[model samples]
Target: MKRQAYRPILITDASRSQDDQLTSRQRRYVMMMGVRVACVIVGAALVGTRAPLLWLWLPLVALGMLLVPWLAVLLANDRPPKDRHRLANRFRAGQQTDAPAMSLTAEERPHKVIDGEP
Candidate 1:
């Protein structure tokens, strides 16, 4: 008998709470920035140690000093990626309604013409 993979079923919305997602992203940003700051300190140390290849170490130092902050800030400010499968401008959240969804384009697929309206 062939064994099938155990796939756990879960709803998209139930997968994560908004606050959890936000806090996780925030943690990632802080950790990455910390690493970037460490790069600068390490680069400075390398240059101070006068590692025979000053030429190589200098660029590393400059890169750590310059690019790291810019990238760190960009990542920190980055928003979560959009879900392509989800629709846009469908309806406002927390909406309550007893009726089923009514099709806005119920006029017919080919679009029939009325006698009075041109």
Candidate 2:
């Protein structure tokens, strides 16, 4: 019997390491939080100095403060979507359900006969 040849995965098809994904998510979370901090600073500065259109500015800044952390947590915890090819088998199986499996009768099926000589 012949052994099958080993196949190597391509670098282009490889997914990122867990550490790399965690590092990227951490960076994104920090950047968004930094923006939230900026929103807080601006709101405080506006309150202290009677800025123009304070009502509008305050609500917009307040909205940023309310939404950023929620979004940051969601994004930070999210992982990348599965590759499309990973889902191909499921779709192929679904398509096959449209057709009923073929069945063969005993006479229609292939068979081997053996004869013994006395």
Candidate 3:
């Protein structure tokens, strides 16, 4: 039988929640701007006869386009940089666990051992 080696797991901090939130907010901002731009273009095309009315929507479309980048930066800055290990441990504690296991595995491990030592 081959002996399966069990090594100690070194868990590092990763802010998954913050990352997810940032991604979600970015998607929303992009979608919002896309929709607003499409609406403005379509509205202008449809109301070609009403020049003044169609022009009125341009400011809103411009504002939406301008706000996308600003809001993305704002939301990204708002997220606090927290220690991932501590955060995960806190979550595990709420679930009645002592220590949260780190997700790192041998395959995904980046550090290399030289001369038969770590």
Candidate 4:
């Protein structure tokens, strides 16, 4: 019987750890919230000073205040998607793909052999 070549998974192809993803999401949420806070401050200042184009600017600032939290929540809850190749086997239901599968056949797997003639 012919033996298939051994394939090794590379660390470089691995996805980011959960903690790393969470930390980044948190940073993004905080930054967006800060922008929302800035919009509030700017709107207050514009009202206090009666800046020119007040009619146009207040609505824009109000829009920012309204949208940022919703977007921030969405982004915070989002996660990186699984790689296509990783799911190919799962959905194919026995179809062979051109890409190498990340597993070994039974014969190719490592195992202990014993002899009865001891």
Please give the TM-score that candidate 2 achieves against the real structure.
Answer: 0.66
Residue lDDT tens for model 1, 1-118: 2333444433862335678767877887788778777877877787788778888877877777687677767766766776654333334467643222332334422366679966
lDDT per residue as tens, model 4, 1-118: 5555656766966899999999999999999999999999999999999999999999999999999999999999999788987676547766756435446667877789898897
Q: Please report how far candidate 4 places residue 66 from its true position, in Å.
A: 0.2
Where is the poorest 10-residue window by lDDT in model 4? 96-105
Better of 1 and 4 by lDDT: 4
Q: Candidate 2: how many backbone clashes?
A: 0
My TM-score estimates for the predictions, one after another, are 0.54, 0.66, 0.33, 0.76
Better of 2 and 3 by TM-score: 2
Candidate 3: give its CA RMSD in angstroms: 11.5
Please report how far candidate 2 places residue 55 from its true position, in Å.
0.7
lDDT of 3 at 36: 61
Global lDDT scores for all candidate models: 0.64, 0.82, 0.60, 0.88
Error of 3 at 2 (Å): 53
lDDT of 2 by residue, 17-113 (tens): 9999999999999999999999999999999999999999999999999999999999999997878874554468536522222344466546898
lDDT of 4: 0.88
The segments of candidate 2 whose C-alpha lies over 4 angstroms from its true place after superposition are 1-8, 85-118
Better of 1 and 3 by TM-score: 1
Per-residue lDDT of 1-118 in model 3, one digit per residue for the tens? 2333444555544346766877777777677667667756766664776656656676665676576567656754565566665556556644775322444456654577678765
